[model samples]
Every structure is written in C-alpha cells, then in structure tokens.
Target: MDAAYVFAVRFRLDPDRGVAVEPETFETRLRRPADDPGESGWLFFRDNLWRGDLADAESFRGLTADALGVLVESVEYRALETDREYYDALREAIAADLAPFNADSVDEVVSKYLGSSVEIRR
Candidate 1:
C-alpha cells in the first residue's frame, strides 16, 4: 500500500506575466508510509503549500505547526488516491482540478512540469 503526498501551492511572481492563474503553482510528489491508511496519499491544497512524506499524522501535523513566513497565505490537505487505484485515480483527479486553473491546455501540463518555456533554456 504505497502512499505519496501531493502539494498544490499558489505563488506570486515578482514581475507579473499577465497570466490569470497567479504567479505559478508547484506540486511535490513524495513517497510515504505504505500501511498508514489513516492519512495515506495526503494532498495539500493551499496558498503556500508545504507537503512531503512523513512517518505519521503527528509528523505531518508538526511540519505545518509553524509558519515559514514567506508569501504563503494558507494550507489545505486530504488523503489523495491510495496505492491500489493510484494509477489513473490520482492522474484524473489532478487534471480535473487543475484544468480550469491552468493557463495552457491540458495536453501541455506535462511539458509545463518539465519547465519547457517559450524562452529556450541554454
């Protein structure tokens, strides 16, 4: 019963790019306990998300206990797709939730994740 943590955070770019979806969103995929069904596949959705793999719910709770004092405004979390249905379940859920907010088409999601931008990387 493999598990992972997904984080969705909202950030504001110093120089506005005229994009409607704020600055940029970052998602962190991390491995976690396999038997912890209580809080398996935790997904953090927040203004400034801070999520990662932890031993137990207590560990996860402790991480967010203190504010990092950045531009972060809020944080949200939930048990995402479990190991059994992780394949399509998590992928579909992410698409469905991010489709409306993404600036580019759904097909480009992967490319965007890889940091493929109009400006070529040297």
Candidate 2:
C-alpha cells in the first residue's frame, strides 16, 4: 500500500473592503512524506498560486487583473496511508475505543472528508 496526502486550501479575502470576496479553494492528492520532487502537485500548485513562481512580473500583473487582489490566509492538509503496519495499527485503535466514538474502520473515518475530488487511500 502507498501513502496519499490530501491538501485542502482555503483563501480568505481582505475584510477591510466593503464587498465580500468569496473564499477560494483547491484540493489535490499526492504520495508520501509531502515533500521532494519540486514538481509535485503540492509544490507546483502552491507555488504558482501563492508565490510569483512564473517567468516574469508581467505574467502576475496581467493574470490578477493589475492588482493582486487575493492573498492566502491559511492552508491545511491531511495524510492517509494503507500499508499493513498502518492498517493493523488502525484496527487496534478502532477495536479499543468507546462505542459512541468508535469507527468501523479507518476507511469509514477517511471517507467522511475524502469528498469527490479525492479518493480514500485504500
């Protein structure tokens, strides 16, 4: 089994302005450790959106409509693994929990937030 990391990003807009700019979001999944391979979905998406990772400032000025109106407020992510060791560990954890808070399996927990853009690692 392999590891898959799911990234869910939320970009909040400036509050001082009179208008309410709707929050923007992007979700992507990737493999293992969340680092390396600078071209990974995580880095490519992150850099391109938040940083001026493009060839020139002209690209940025042109893309954001002359004013870089949006700025990133926060980012959050989750990691999932389905290897034998992880599976066995989750099984033990589920088995020894209280009924009200108990989960049928790791898949059950992961599925709750996996949504359509992503798949449960299993």
Candidate 3:
C-alpha cells in the first residue's frame, strides 16, 4: 500500500516568459510507502511543515513555481491519506523519533506536523 501527501495549488504562466495561459489549479500528491514511516527521504512533513501547516508559504510557492514553470499564486494543504495499518506504523515511528522533538508523545508530534489533516482510509 501507499500514502500520499496531497495539496491544491493555483498558478499562472508568466506572460513575459512565454505565451500566457489562464490561471490554473490542480491537486498534487507526493507519494510514499504506507508502512515506511521512518524512511529518511520520507521526511517531507518534518521539513516543510510547522504546527500542521507549511513552514514557509513563499518558499513552497517558489519550489512549485520552479517545478511547474509558472507563477504559483497559492497553495493549500490537503491531507495525508493512508490506510489504518500504515497509520499505526507511522504513529509508532513517531513515538520512537520523539526524543529529539519538543513533543512528549506521538500524538503531540502528529498534531504538530499533521494536525487534523490526516485521513485514515480502509
């Protein structure tokens, strides 16, 4: 099984750079293994999130702009969608990794990074 961190992005093409198109919107997903919560490269939440939201919207918009070659106007955090089995593993991993963080429990860590945006699907 796999999980995805999903987001909604709104962007526009720069007229100076190329033929300008109308502003557009789309949903994007960064996919990962459902069970591998401790994978080093799977630290997207830790790196990009703060208190359940993007740590820096301007930086995120810049990254999106570069990736899509457009002017990113806005970004909205959606949810971390995964299965119940994987969610359990992720909570366990968060508990193990809690030593270095300021939180005292896995729930705190999850709340800090993901908040109410976690969706556990069957």
Collision count for each candidate, in order:
0, 0, 0
Model 2 lDDT, residue 16, Cα: 73
The lDDT values for all models are 0.36, 0.37, 0.74
Better of 1 and 2 by lDDT: 2
Expressed as tens digits, the lDDT of each residue in 1-122 for candidate 1 is 34443433333233457646543443333332323422333233222122322224444444543333234333334333345444244345546666433635433542333222112112
Model 2 residue 56 lDDT? 38
lDDT of 2 at 24: 42
lDDT of 2 by residue, 3-114 (tens): 3444333344556757664544433332334332222452332333222122233443344332334553333343343455444544454445525333465455334333
Best by TM-score: 3
TM-score, ranked from best to worst: 3, 2, 1
Residue pairs with colliding backbones in model 3 are none
Give one digit per residue, the lDDT tens place, for model 3 in 1-122: 46777767877555665566554444454343433677765668777777767888889878877877877787766788987877888888777778766789988888888888999897
Q: How big is the RMSD of model 1?
A: 15.5
